[model samples]
Target: MTKITYVTTHGERIDTEAENGATVMETAIMNAVPGIVAECGGACTCATCHVYIDDAWRETVGGPSSMEEDMLDFAFDVKDSSRLSCQIKVRDALDGLVVHVPSRQG
Candidate 1:
C-alpha cells in the first residue's frame, strides 16, 4: 500500500494507505479525510476535490492535464501547486505523498 497524508485547511493531518491504482481522491474518500468532496466521483468533471500538491512532491506529481487545467479554472485559490485529487493516481512511487486540502472547494 502507498501511504498518503492529507493536511486539512484547519491544519489537521489525516494519514491513510491505499492500494496501487486508486486515485488520491479515492483514498481520501475511503479514509473519510475531510475537504475532498469528489462530487463527480473521480470523473475529473469538477473541482470539488481540489488540493495543493506539497512543494516537495510537486515534481513527482507533475502538472495537471490540459483538460484538468480547464476545470481547475473553477477551483478556489488556484496556485502553481493546485490539483484535483481525482486526477492523481496512487502508486508505490508516491508512498509518502502529501497534499493540502484547501479551505473550501470550488
Candidate 2:
C-alpha cells in the first residue's frame, strides 16, 4: 500500500494507506479524511476533491492534464500547486505522497 498524507486546512494531518491504481480521492474518502468533498465521484466533472500538491512531491505528482486543468477552474483558491485528487493515481512511486486540502470545496 502507498502511504499518503493529507494536511487539512485546519492543520489536521491524516495518513492513509492506498492500494496501487487507486486515486487519491478514493483513499481520502475511504479513510474519512475531512475536506475532500469529491462531489463528482472522480468523474473529473467537479473540483470538490481539489488539493494542493506539496512542493516536495510536485514533480512526482506532475501537473494536471488539460482536461483536469479546465475542471479545476471551478475549485476554490486555485494555485500553481492545485490539483484534483481524483486525477492522482496511487503507485509505488507515490508511496509517500503528501497533499493539502483547501479550506472549502467549489
Q: Which prediction has the highest lDDT against the true structure?
A: 2
- Model 2: how far residue 78 lies from native, Å: 0.4
lDDT of 1 by residue, 6-30 (tens): 9998999999998899999999999
Every model's TM-score: 0.98, 0.98
Kindly list the per-residue Cα lDDT of model 2 for residues 1-106, writing each as its tens digit.
8999999988988989999999999999999999989988999999999999999999999999999999988999999999999999999999889999999998
Q: Worst ten-residue run, lDDT, model 1?
A: 10-19
| lDDT computed for candidate 1 | 0.95
| Candidate 2 global TM-score | 0.98
- All candidates' lDDT scores? 0.95, 0.95
